[model samples]
Target: MTRLMDQEQENLWDSVQILSQINAEKAKAVFKVTIEKSLQQLGITVPVFSTIRLSVPSTDRLSQLRQIEKKMREAYAHQEKEKAYEYLVDYIERLSQMTEDDPLVVRKKLLASLLNERYKRKPKWSAKRYRLSASLSPLLSKQVAAAYYTTSEVAKKLGLSDQTIRRMCEKGKFPGAYKTDGGHWRIPRKIFITTPEQDERAEEALQQIDIKNQKAGYVDEFDL
Candidate 1:
């Protein structure tokens, strides 16, 4: 009977040790993931420290993109539409060269679409602008085009005057509202007139994009 009890005690101790080891391993994995995510947010990738080596190249590309986007925003703030458009063209050209299957390419394409929309109603819309917008259209999904509403379109939709819509947008009544270089307001359709089904679809789309982005070794959190 004493031998039997000793054997049972040994088995219990072994199980306890196994459980403790598993918990420790899990904690280490969680810590590594947390560190990796924090570094990614800062646009830093240390391949030697991370198991996700594939992310290093993409992260470098994203850093380059962020610099270009910064220049574009600066140009926009200074009311230099032409300069901003030039930067946008450069940005899209770089994204086009990346593999189409890349999730980053899709996200960047949507951003490029938004930037392209800003110049659509330019008073001095040039042939160059038209060509650039046209070339970029094929690269973007139709959903991106459907996501924004022009000031006049919103006015018509809400049965309000265009001036009223612009005033509301400027007063922060509209979420995701942005002014174009031509001083026109563009509103996000999702925030303005989306039905529950539309909202669900949009959420699902974003979740799918997130999943694909994760598989691609990065998460997209940057905006123009």
Candidate 2:
């Protein structure tokens, strides 16, 4: 009996380590199976564990700004100059609203100002730039107010239904969870499970954003 318990404990620890390495979607599937098997092996009839809670620090709004910049890059790559300009203008507007003292935002705003000036000086550069910006004004105004995980995202990670996550949030089961001004539940990333790969991808994307920003003649303080 002692040996069996020891082996099960070891297996449980290994399973947790694996969970921390994989993406949330994949981890949910593995979590259910592993927990159940581990319990059965220990001769437990009832499930002992409920939800797997993992905490990661919350990312700033700059991450979303970086994502919008990537979309702009993709648009330009596809020769969608109109779409790219729309994304650029939207990106600038978001930067303007950010209250953080991030120096990167200042550099990006400068680059965007330069790009906007180029557009005015050379209308032939993108004939649809003004027209699309005007048409997309309403859409651009509907920005995501905060950086948070949706109920569905939390639900998948916790192996619960979306409704259940919503209920839990309402009952204050999740610390740091709150409803947006629009009345939608927003779960902070700090209370959410995150994988190392996700963090690596976010870091890579920020590095790319910085490189692109620097190419526009704004040098980083570190580079100086």
Could you report the Cα RMSD, in angstroms, for every candidate shown?
Answer: 20.8, 24.2
TM-score of each: 0.29, 0.27
lDDT tens per residue, model 1, 1-224:
22342343333223223222334332223223333222222222232232111121243554565467556655665788788768766654554443334545554544544444433453554323322233466655254446667878765443346887787777766645666445667666544323334334433443444465467643333110
**Model 2, span 39-153: residue lDDT tens:** 2222122211222332211234434654675566566657887887677667556544542345356535445444443343423443122222334556542332233568887
Candidate 1, residue 126: Cα displacement in angstroms equals 28
Segments in model 1 whose C-alpha atoms lie over 4 Å from true places: 1-57, 98-224
* Clashing residue pairs found in predicted model 1: none
The whole-model lDDT of each prediction reads 0.44, 0.45
**Candidate 1 — what's its lDDT?**
0.44
For model 2, the run of ten residues with the poorest summed lDDT: 42-51
